[model samples]
Target: MNTDARSHVHALIDRLPPVQLAALETILQSMLDPLSRKLALAPIDDEPFTEEDRQAVAEADEWLKDNQPVPLENVLADFGLGMTDWETMAKTPLPEETGKRNG
Candidate 1:
């Protein structure tokens, strides 16, 4: 983390009441478990935001909010492989035919 971010966190912690500070300490310590510690140490990746993805997510959220018909299964099926067929798909070769050894 940057120096500015560290200063900001310190400022917030310094302003907390005794009870709130204890609660925050408890929550922070709980996150230090073996599995959670590994997750916390993982690097954060930045993904570029695309207009198409933003639009799709907004539409899906609106549909769910209004209790409208949302075709999630069909949308997922169009990804070409289903849950059971994922292993078979992983073993299949790519469409490109460049790599081959003719005996």
Candidate 2:
């Protein structure tokens, strides 16, 4: 974020009541959780891949070369699901709770 935007956010945070601050913290964490997971999973530049990782990548490449890409619609149809179903699924909460505030 730019300095101005960060300053604005800080000002807003300073004005928030304790309960609201807690809620804001929760909301921000939820927003960042996916990004944090992706970052954590991303390979480090200095780290070497294990033999298993190399084998998995090779197998995946071979499979991709051998098989034609299937249309997403066809795949979804096989499961009796459509685009709408996918959209709904994407919006639905997972079984695990993140302890988000109800309000």
Candidate 3:
């Protein structure tokens, strides 16, 4: 809890113009998200494209041309989970793991 640092950061934010402020907000919001931060920092894939990779990319491109994108909720629903289940799953212990300790 560095109040002085926070105040200084806020003061700097206050001095930014509308466009720079918007960009700063986007950058800050992205850094706060663990997945987004990892994705932003991750290096580009440099591996040579194999036949499988080429086929997969062609299939994906064809599918995109003909079909709509699948929603995250629908994908999760296929696994008997929902968008809101992530928090609960993280907090709850697995039944097999619990049994192993209790047995």
Query: Which candidate should be chosen as best, given TM-score against the real structure?
Result: 3
Lowest summed lDDT window (length 10), candidate 2: 33-42
lDDT of 1: 0.73
TM-score on alpha carbons, each prediction? 0.34, 0.42, 0.48
Clashing pairs in 1: none
Tens digits of per-residue lDDT, candidate 2, 47-80, equal 7889999999999889989898789989999999
lDDT of 1 by residue, 21-69 (tens): 9988866865755444445565786778899999999999888887967
- Where is model 2 more than 4 Å wrong at Cα? 1-49, 98-103
TM-score of 2: 0.42
Better of 1 and 2 by lDDT: 2
lDDT to native, each model: 0.73, 0.81, 0.82
Query: In model 1, which range of ten residues has the least summed lDDT?
Result: 89-98
- lDDT string, candidate 3, 64-88, tens digits: 9989999978888899998679756
Candidate 2, lDDT over the whole model: 0.81
Q: Which scores higher on TM-score, 2 or 3?
A: 3
